[model samples]
Target: MTTQHRTIAFIGAGNMTQSIVGGMVASGYPADAIFVSNPSPGKLEKIAAELGVHTSQDNAEVANKADVIVLAVKPQLMADVCAALREQVAHLADKLIVTIAAGIRISKYRQYLGDDIRMIRVMPNTPSLVGKGMSGLVADDRVDDSDKSFITTAFDGVGATLWVSDEDELDILGAVAGSGPAYFFEFMASLQKAAVALGFDRDKARQMVQQTALGAAEMAIHSELELEDLRKQVTSKGGSTAKGIEQYQAYDIDKISADAVKAAVKRNQEMAELF
Candidate 1:
């Protein structure tokens, strides 16, 4: 199976689906080979008009045609969606099923689809909209290498990919990379508020904080040094940067971050039980 020739179908035309589709097309995945379906026509219309992919209101119709089916719907709706596609199981048995819904485990999917279904679970972040997302993937042992390669290539168009050894780790990855963007956004919002308190206008404060965040992230990506080293490089002994660092340390930022990640992981577990 050549990845390029594989017809990929997105079962839901939500934002994440749109972002992945947009990124894939932007990265030169053939739009004609992509199929998308949704119960509602509005998003379908927008995506088809914008990206030129095949669109349908019928889930089974797209599933029948696709070599790879991406289940991009919300977690709460997953059971119903899979139930609707149960009639087409015979037709879909050989195709790869890729799911992006969080918290739902592969076992749950096997229960929904079939006991022998070859599936891959992916946790992707919002940054995929801009071609810089991080996706963590875990695949069933039954999935072939060729299918793995195809899924990897498909996601790489949107961002970097990491394959975890266990499905349990996928939840941990979800806590970090999955919910990580909002953490940075919160910090940036705090900085913007501080800047406003110090007399900078809201817009200017936001602009400064956002650009600095981007620059810091880019530096971390390109630099060989560890994050602690990078922070030290910015802070001279007893300087203003050191003072700020002292405040963060005094506030137990490490503990705060750990607690946040733990909370996210706990919520993921809860969702799994619910689904």
Candidate 2:
């Protein structure tokens, strides 16, 4: 089915949902067919005004009106939100339920929304706000191929997507790509600070860092060579890049990055348990 025929209801009108809605509308999906619900009328008003999508304060109202329901609320509030919609979900066997709330597993949702719900769990990062997201998706066995294709198409409007076999992989990808943007941001900030300390202005440092980063990432995406080969190409035998690489190796940066990802994974597990 085409996007125009599908009515997607966003249960929360947050930045991420707004981003998805914006991308969908830009990609030719009918804005009038999209519905957004938020507890706060201010967000709903802004989204409706900006995207021209329908908005509501009642989650169930939105859910009842759509073929797809997106649970975009925070994990801490998911239980309460699901509880409020439990009754309306009984006849939703034909509808697709997609959750973007992190750490809340499918089992927890089943406990409230029912075991037979055609649910899919998606882990998407904040970069989706700029239409450059990396999303990891996993779905319940009950979700058919058509549902999977439709959901994948929707996310593709924002950026790339991957389908993993199990929900555990979502947690792992969450550690990698879901929280990955912040790691890059931190690295860029460090570069900017070092450049400033070396006598460059902050704006010039940031511009240099951002453009270099953009170029490097684009090269990686388009290059057939391995990343290590790309690095080798940039580093001369005794040049500045080689010296920088030597310092990075000397500091065990690879191990530090691995440990950081492991910590994020552990914290994700902790959140799954807590929320």
Candidate 3:
């Protein structure tokens, strides 16, 4: 909450950028301490009005003012953005650059900046908008302990943070943890609609589906039992649970779920290669 030493900047003033800015403000950082900017006046106005941070249409201005620069733009624009501001960013040699853009590797950032600059790449999901996100962080060798501490607090405002030895694992997680929420949301919606078709009230059906999802997640988190063990425990012979599991197994549900995640991981890897 004590952000007297903070001067954070976000390069793209989009939804995810505002979410992190909101978290920083909520954590006691002065609203004035954050800065966000985009090429569009509309986006700058929207993000600035919402968070009361300084906003500009210039990336270099934001970079000059920030102690930590957050790059939230689409991955396709990263190289151009870097090249555009490369000369102006030499002053940021003492600062840390945190990037939340997916598939943009830290190695790529190193190629853009001077050897003196420190860089870290993070994979954060949209759930951070509700303060329940997951972020995986991996830093370049140039980063110092002080920089890590600051970055830890910066990301902690969003949700849980996991630091990994090899960020390769995160490319897969960008599928499971990053793009994963949508998959489950779709599954829940399907279940709720099925319940409604079976004559349950819409609101009641939704509540049932929500609770079932929450309970299953809690079981996975709190118990030492493996997921398969928990599934086996609930599935007694010839019961409804067993019947559902049997149906799922009969249709090769496991393979289907795996294929979904694999497809995502593969695409993410391909994107990483391109950049």
lDDT of 2: 0.90
Cα RMSDs of all predictions? 1.2, 1.4, 2.7
Poorest lDDT segment (10 consecutive residues) of candidate 3: 1-10
Report the C-alpha lDDT of model 1 over 247-266, residue by residue, as the tens digit.
99999999999999999999
**Preferred candidate (TM-score higher): 2 or 3:** 2
lDDT (tens digit, per residue) of candidate 3 on 1-275: 33356788899988888878888878877878888879989978876777788998899998888888999999889898887767776576777788999998777887876566788888998888888888888887777777777777777889978877667888877888899889989889989999999899999999999999989987898999989999899889889988787877898988988999999999998988999
Backbone clash pairs in model 2 (N, Cα, C under 3 Å; residues 3+ apart or in different chains), count? 0
C-alpha lDDT score of every prediction, in listed order: 0.91, 0.90, 0.84
**lDDT per residue (tens digit) for residues 1-275 in model 2:** 56446998999888899888888888888898899999989999898888899999989999998999999988888989988888764477678899999999899888878777879999998889899999999998998888898888889889999999998888899999998999999999999999999999999999999999999999999999999999999999999999999998999998989998999999999899986
lDDT for 199 (candidate 3): 99
Give the poorly placed runs of model 2, Cα more than 4 Å off: 1-4
Model 3 residue pairs with clashes: none
In candidate 1, which residue ranges exceed 4 Å CA deviation? none
Per lDDT, what order, best first?
1, 2, 3
What TM-score would candidate 1 get against the native? Answer: 0.96
Error of 3 at 78 (Å): 1.4
Candidates, ranked, TM-score: 1, 2, 3
